[model samples]
Target: MLNRLYFIFLLVPFLFLSCYDSNGDTEKSATLPIYQDTPYLQDYSVKYYFNSSVSPKKVFEDRNGVVQVLGKNGLYRTSAGQFLVDGTLIADNTYRPLKDKSLNGISLFQDQFVYVDDKAVLSNAWAGNLFLPHDLENANLLEPGSNFDFLISDGKELQFLSKDKAPWKGTVEDGNIIQIRYGHEANVFWILGKNSVSTFDASNNQIKTIKINNEATSFDVVGAKLYIGTQNGYFTVDSELNGKPSDLINKLPVPSITWIESIDEEIWFGSDEGAYRMDIDGDFNYYYGKRWLPGNKVVHISSGHEGRVHILTDNGLAQIHFDPMTLADKAAFYEKQVRDRHIRLGFNASLVDLKNGDVNSGRLDDSDNDGLWTSMYLASQVYRYKVTGNEEALKNCYESMEAMERLFTINDVPGFPSRSFERSGYIESLHDSDRWQHTDDPEWDWKSTTSSDEAIGHIFVYSVMAELLENDLRERAITLIDTLMGHIVKNDYYLVDFDGKPTTWGKWNPEYVNARPIMVGDRKINSSNIIAMLQTAYHFTQKEVYKEKAFDLMNNHGYFENLMRPMSEIGKAPEDADDWSKMLSEGWNHSDDEMYFLGYWGLYRYALNDTLKTKFKESIIDHWESERPEKDGAWNLLTAVCETQNFDLDEAAWYLREHPMDMRSWDVKNSHRKDLTFIEPNFRDQTTEEVLPPDERQVQRHNANMFRLDRTGGDGSEEYSAGDIWLLPYWLGRYLGVISEPRLNKE
Candidate 1:
C-alpha cells in the first residue's frame, strides 16, 4: 500500500512538470535575449576643477563651446556661455544653466550635467530637476564629509553619485530614489577626501571605502584606475569599488604630492619638491627634479590631443617631447662616442718623449717637455680600451707608439742608431741638457744632466712597454735591455761620468762624489735603481733572477728599510720647524728624506714578497679611520701604494674613497719659474718662458695642491706632471674590471 501511494505521488508530479511544451516533446532549448549596452561619447572642450580657501570646490567645463560651472554660488548657465564671478566674466558661444546658486561639485554626462552643492541637481537645456536635500555638504558620498560629481550613461539609464551622508545615490523606475545607481550598465564614480577614498558603482548601486592612513594630499583617475597621493608616497586602485590598492611605483621621496593627472595612460604626479611620470603599468622612467626642472615644485599637468603633455610648475611651464625610440638611440650613441674619444685622446704619445728622436731636445725643451713614464703609462691604458671593442682609438695609440720608438737609443754609445741597430743590446736615458741649459748662464749647463733617479724610472717604463708590444718590437726591446745591463755592469753599480771616471756626480751633478748612487742620509744602499732594473726584468721575462733581486733590495738594505723608520727619527729642523717637517714627511725633501721614492718602493714590494702587501693593507685601513694631518699622510701614502701594487677591486675602491682626487686644486708655484722642474722621473728641464710657454704655464698658486696616485709634484710645482692623469686610467681600468687579468704561469 505504501509503495502504490509513493508511485502515484511521483507520477503525478512528473506528468504536471512534463506538460510545459504543447508538442509533447522534451524541450530542445530555452531562448533568452542578449543584452547589449549602448556606448555614449561625451564631447567636452575643456574640463577642470578648482579648489580655493575662500570658496567651495568647483567643477567647470566648456561643452560644445559653451562654458558652464557648478560652484558654491549655485548651478549656473548662460545662453551666450558667459558667467560672471568676483568681477571676472568668462564668456563663450552657447551656454545653458545647469544649476543655480545651490550646486558645487559638477560633471558632464552626455548632453547633461549632474551636480550637488546646496542641493542634489541634474540638468540639461531641455529640463532640470533637484532631489534630496538642498544642503548635502555633509553627505557620505564615499567617506564622511566628502562628495563627488555623479557619473551617468544613457544605456544604463542611471547615474552613480557619491555623497557625504548617503555614500551613494541612484534612481528607481518607480520614481523612487535610492542612494545608488539602479541600472546594470552604470558608470563608476569616486569620492576623494583629505585622508580617505570611497568608490561608488552605478551597476550594483554599491559603495566601497578605503582609508589612507597617510593624508590624501592629491588624487587623479585614468580609465578604470584611480591614483591617490598621500603624505608618504602614492597608491593606486584597480577599479572603482573592487580589488586591493597598489603603490604608485617608484614615487620619489618628497614631502607631499600637490597635484596629479593622467596623460596618454601615463601618470604625472607633482609634489612640493619636483615632478615624476610613470606609465599605466607603473613603470617609472622619467623624472624632472631641481637638476632638470627650473622649479623645485610642480603645480599642475594638462594633457592635449596626440600624446602631448604640458606641465606647470612653480618656476613656470614646460613642454616635453617623449618618444621612446629616439631617447634610447641617443643614449646609446652618447655612450659609444665618449668611450672612443677618451681612448684616442689618452694615447697620443707625441705629447711626451719615449722615442729615439730629438723631439724634446730642441723646440720641445723650451716648452715643458711632457714626461716619459706618464706617456707610456697612458699608451698602455689606451691600448687596454682599444682591445675591448673600441677600435676607433687604435690608430691614435699606434701612431703615438711609432713616434716614441724613434726618441731613444738601444745603446749608451752617443749618436742615433740606424734601423740595423735593432739587434743592439740595452737602452740608455738620453740626457739632453743643451736644450734646457741657460745660454746666458754657464753655471746651469752642468746642472741640467740626467739624474740616476730619472734613469731608474725610465728603465721600468721601457720594460712595461716592451711587455705590451708586438714580437718584432719585443725583440728590439730585448736588445735594448741587454745593452743597458752591460752599461750598468761596466760602471760598477754607478752611472759613468761624461769623462769616463767614477766621479761623484756623472751627468746630474759633477761636483759631489758618491751622490750619483746615494740614499737618504745615514741610510745604506739606496737600491731604487737596482729595484727598478729587477722589476723591469721580472715584468718582461717573468724570470726568477729578477724576482730574487727585488726581494734582496726590499729585505734589509733597500729603499724600503731605509724609509721605514718613524717620522721623528729622521731629518733636521728648519727655521720654520712645523712647515718644514710637514714638507719633509710629504716627500718634498728629495735629499735627506727618501719619501719621494715611496712609489718605487711600493712597486718593488708588490713585485716581490707578501710582507709588503700586508703592510699596505694595514696602512690604508688606519688612514681611512684616522683624523686630520695623519689622515692626509695616510691618504697620500696609500694612494701611491695602491697604484704600484695594482690592488684588486675591493682594495682600490676603499683607497679611492679615502683619498679623493681633487683635480681642481692643481696650481703652479712662483718659485718654480727660476729653477728646473722635473715633470716625471725621466723628464726634467729648466723653466724658461719657452719651456713652459707663457700661455700654457698658468700661475695659479693652487696647482701644486692637487695630488695624484702615482705622479709626485714637479720641482716648480705648476700643473700636473705628464704621468699624473695618464697613468691613472691604467690602474683605474684594472680596478674597474675594464681589462681582463693576464694569464700567468704558476711556479
Candidate 2:
C-alpha cells in the first residue's frame, strides 16, 4: 500500500503536464537542444585615436592583417594592441629607407604593397619596382587591375600600367572623376563621378557613361555588380553597365553614403551619420555613435585582422571585433560586469557620471527604485542558484537579501521598506532630499515616500525565495513576506510612513483603486499587484487573515474583472472622468508592465485554487499577446510560466543575443534611419511599425519605451548595471528549462 501511494504521487506531475498541454493547440517546449550552445558572433569594439589635428582619409589592412590609416600628414600603423604607431618606410637592398612623405595613395596586389607618390606608382614586391615613373601626374588614388598591372587615378584622369604591356589612359566622358575602382570579376574599371558612372573595358579600351538620378558620391565593385552611391541613396549597376532606378534600392537607415566597400563578401556602407553592414537577410547591423565608433563621419572602410571591420572616421579609427559567443558565455560576462563595479553596499547600483565610458572614472549611486532594482537582481541570483546549483549564486542571493532586510530595519516603521539607504551626510547630493530621513544610527539615512512598486518587488523576491530556498533562508523569506503584508493589511491597504500618512502611489484601498475608470492602467495594475501580494503572503505564512483579505478584495471589490479586461479595451479615460483618472490614462504606463509581470509569478503560481489558476493563466496570456510586438525577452520568458505553447522563444533568444555588450548609456540616434516606418502617435508611445534591435537604440531598462529612437546631448556619463535588465530574464529562462546549459565550459 505504501509503494502504491508513492507511485500515485509520482504520477501527479505527469498528469498535470499532460492536462496542461490539452489547453493549448501547440506543444510548449524549447526548440533548441537542452545542452548545446547556439553559436553566433558577438561583436565588441576596439578604437584607435590619433592627435586631434590629424585628418584620417583612408584605411586598409597590411600584408600581416594589421590596420593602417592614411591621413593628410602621413600614414599611421596600428600596433599589436590597436595603439597608434608612426608609419615606417620599407628598406631596399642597400638598407636605404624609402621616403614616406607625401604618400597620397595605397593599395595591395597579390598581398604585396603598391603605393603612389607625386610622380610614380611604387611597390616593394620585386626588389623595389617603380612602374609608370614620371608618367602619372599628381596621382591621388591607386587600385589593382584585373587584366593589367595597376590602375592609377589623379581625380581628373585614369592611367593603367603593366609590366609587359603598354600603359592605357582614359578620362571620364560625362564628368570629372571622383573615384576609380577595378572590377576584378568583370575585368572592367568602374569610374564614379559627381553625377554619373563610367565603365572602362581595358581589353578593348571601351568606355560607357550613364547619368544617375542623384549626384553620385561613392562606388564599389563586387565581381559583375557595381554599387553606386549618391547623395540621397544608392543603386546597382551590372557588368553590362545597366543601371537600376534609384528608388528601387534606396531603402536604408542612413542614405547619405560617403564610402562603400565589399568586405568579407558583405556590403558595408559608410555615411555621414555612422557605419552599417548589410547581412544576408538584407537587414542592417548599425554601428553608430561613441558606442561603436569614435566619430560619425566615416571616410573609409576595410577588412581587418581575423574578420574585424576597420572603419576610419574624421576623428579616429574604430575596429569592430566579432567574437564567437553563446548566450551562456554572455551571461558569465554580465555576471563579472555586475560584480566588478555595480555592487554598492550589497545593493545593485548604477555607475553614473563616467567620463567617456571609463569604468574607473565613475561612482556607484543609489536610485529611486532601490528595492525594486535589487529585488530583480536578487531574483536573478535565486534562479541562478536553482538552475546551476552554484554556491556563488546563493552567496549573491544572501548578500542582497541582507540589503532587503535592512530596508525594513533601517527605519522606525514596522514593515515599511525604505526606497533606499545611503551613508549619512550626503542628503544634499540625493535627488529630492526632502524624502530623505535620518536613522537612529548616525551613520546612515533612509529615503521615504516608498510606493507600491517597492512593496510588490519586495513581495515578489520574498515569495520566490520562500518557494525555492532551503533551511534558514526559506524561513526568513516567509517571515519578511508576512511582516510586509501584515503592515499593509493593518494600515487598510496603505503603506503608511513614519509621519502617519499614506504615501502617494502606495494606496490600494477600495476607495483609491476603484475610483479610476476601468480603462486606466493603474486601476488594472494596482488591483493585480495587491491581489498577488496578498496571495503570496497567504501561501507562505498560512495566515487565514491574508487569505480572507485577498478573497474580500477579489469578490467584493471586483479586482478580477479589472485585471482580466482585454488590453485592446484599455485607452484614454472617458471625457467626463476626474482629472487624476484622465491623467493616469493619458498613456500606457510601461512601469506598470514591469510590475504586472513581476506580480504574475504569485498570481498564477500561488493561486488559491486550480480554477483561479486557469483564469490567471488566461489573463497572463492576454497581456503577453499585447506585448508580442516589442519582442521583450523578459516578458516572453515570464509568459512561459503560464504553459502557453508559443511565447516567442526565438525572439527571446534574439533579444538575449542582440543586446549590446556595452551597458553604458551612449547617445544613440535612430530617428534618421530611412528604413523605419513612422506611425500615428498613440497612448503606448510606439513610434515605429517595428522595434529596432537592442544594439541599435539607447541602452535602457525594461520600464523605458522600446520604440524610443534618439538620445541627443548625451555624453556617455552613466553606465547601467545588467543585473536587473539582462540577468533577470536570462537566469529566469535557465530556471524554467527553456534556455540550455553552457556547452562551453563555464570556466
Q: Which one wins on TM-score? A: 2
Runs in model 2 lying further than 4 Å from the true structure:
1-36, 79-100, 124-134, 146-148, 211-213, 242-248, 744-747
Which candidate number would show the highest lDDT if scored against the true structure? 2
Q: lDDT tens digits, residues 1-747, model 1?
A: 122223235334432322111121111112211111111111101112222222323223333433343334443232221000001113222333432243444444443444444444444433553243433443222111113344432211234444433434342232211122212223444555555565555446665666555556667766666667765667777655467778544324353677777766677777765555666565343233311233445655645322334444454333333322211122122223223222222222122231211112211111112223333343333434333323333443454445334333322343211111111111122233232322233322222233343344345434534654454555655554444443554454445534455323222111221222222232322343455465555656566765665665466334455434333333333444445233323332322112223234334443455665555444433322321121122133324334333223333222222221111111222331112233442111122221321112221111122222112232221222222232332332332232222212211
Candidate 1, residue 499: how far the Cα is off, in Å:
25
Cα lDDT, all candidates: 0.36, 0.80
Instruction: State the displacement of the C-alpha of residue 150, model 2, in Å, after optimal TM-score superposition.
Output: 1.2
- Give the count of colliding residue pairs in each prediction: 47, 0
